[model samples]
Structures are given as C-alpha cells and as structure tokens.
Target: MSGGVVTRGRERRDQQNGQNSKTTEQKRDEEQVQLAEANSLALTMRSGLQAISKEIRDLKTEMKKDLTTLKEQVTEDVKSEINDLK
Candidate 1:
C-alpha cells in the first residue's frame, strides 16, 4: 500500500508539471504575437509621421515664396507712389 501511494503521488506531480509547462508555452506564444502587432503599429505610425513632416516642409517653402513676392510687390508700389507725389 505504501509503495502504491508513493507512485500515485509522483504520477500526480508529473501531470501537474506537464500542465504547467503547456501553460507557460501558451503564454509565451501570446506574448510573441502581441509584440509583433506592437512593432507593426509602431512602424505604421513612423511612416505617417514622415509623410506629415514632408507636407509641413512643403507648406513652409510655399509660404516663404509667397512672402517674398508680397514684399517685392509692396516695394514697387511704394516707389511708384513716391514718384507720382514728386
């Protein structure tokens, strides 16, 4: 009877260990999937940010060109007005 009990106890412990190993493996797989998704999202966001940065740069260039044109026009108008007053 004593030998039988010891064998049964070992069997139960082995079963529990197997179950724990399976659970750990499942958790590792889930973590890997989540990490992959997070990396993909980060890459997508970086691409969007790059596009936005380019658009902002283009807008700045256009605004500078417009300001330069306006300054030249204003200078010409002022010169014309002074000559007419004289």
Candidate 2:
C-alpha cells in the first residue's frame, strides 16, 4: 500500500507540472503577440509623424513666400502714393 501511494503521488506531481508548463507556454505566446502589435503601432505612428513634419515644413516655406510678396507689393504701393502727393 505504501508503494502504491508513492506512485500515485508522483503521478499527481507530474500532472501538475505539465499543467504549469502549458500555462507558461500560453502566456509567453500571448506576450509575443502583444509585443508585435505594439511594434507595428509604433512604426505606423512614426511614419505618420514624419509625413506631418514634412507637410508643416512645406507650408512654412509657402507662407514665407506669400508674406514676402505681400510686403513688396505694400512697399511699392506706399511709394507710389508718396510720389502722387508730391
């Protein structure tokens, strides 16, 4: 009877270890999937930020040109008005 009890105990322990190993493997797989998704999201955000930065730079350049043209036109108009007064 003692030998039978020892064998049963060992079987139970082995079953428990197997269950723990399976659970650990499942958790590791889930963590890997989550890490991959996070990496993909980060890459998408980086690309979007880069595109927005380029658009802002282009807009700034265009605005500067428009402002310079307006300033030149205003200066010419003021000069013409002064000449007319003289």
The residue pairs in collision within model 1 are none
Top-scoring candidate (TM-score): 2
Give the per-residue lDDT of model 2 (tens digit) for 1-86.
99999999999999999999999999999999999999999999999999999999999999999999999999999999999999
Clashing pairs in 2: none
Scored against the true structure, residue 77 in model 1 reaches a CA lDDT of 100
Q: What is the C-alpha lDDT of each candidate?
A: 1.00, 1.00
Residue-level lDDT tens digits of model 1 in 20-65: 9999999999999999999999999999999999999999999999
- The list of candidate 1 runs beyond 4 A from truth reads none
Which 10 residues in a row give candidate 2 its minimum summed lDDT?
Answer: 21-30
**Clash count, one per candidate:** 0, 0
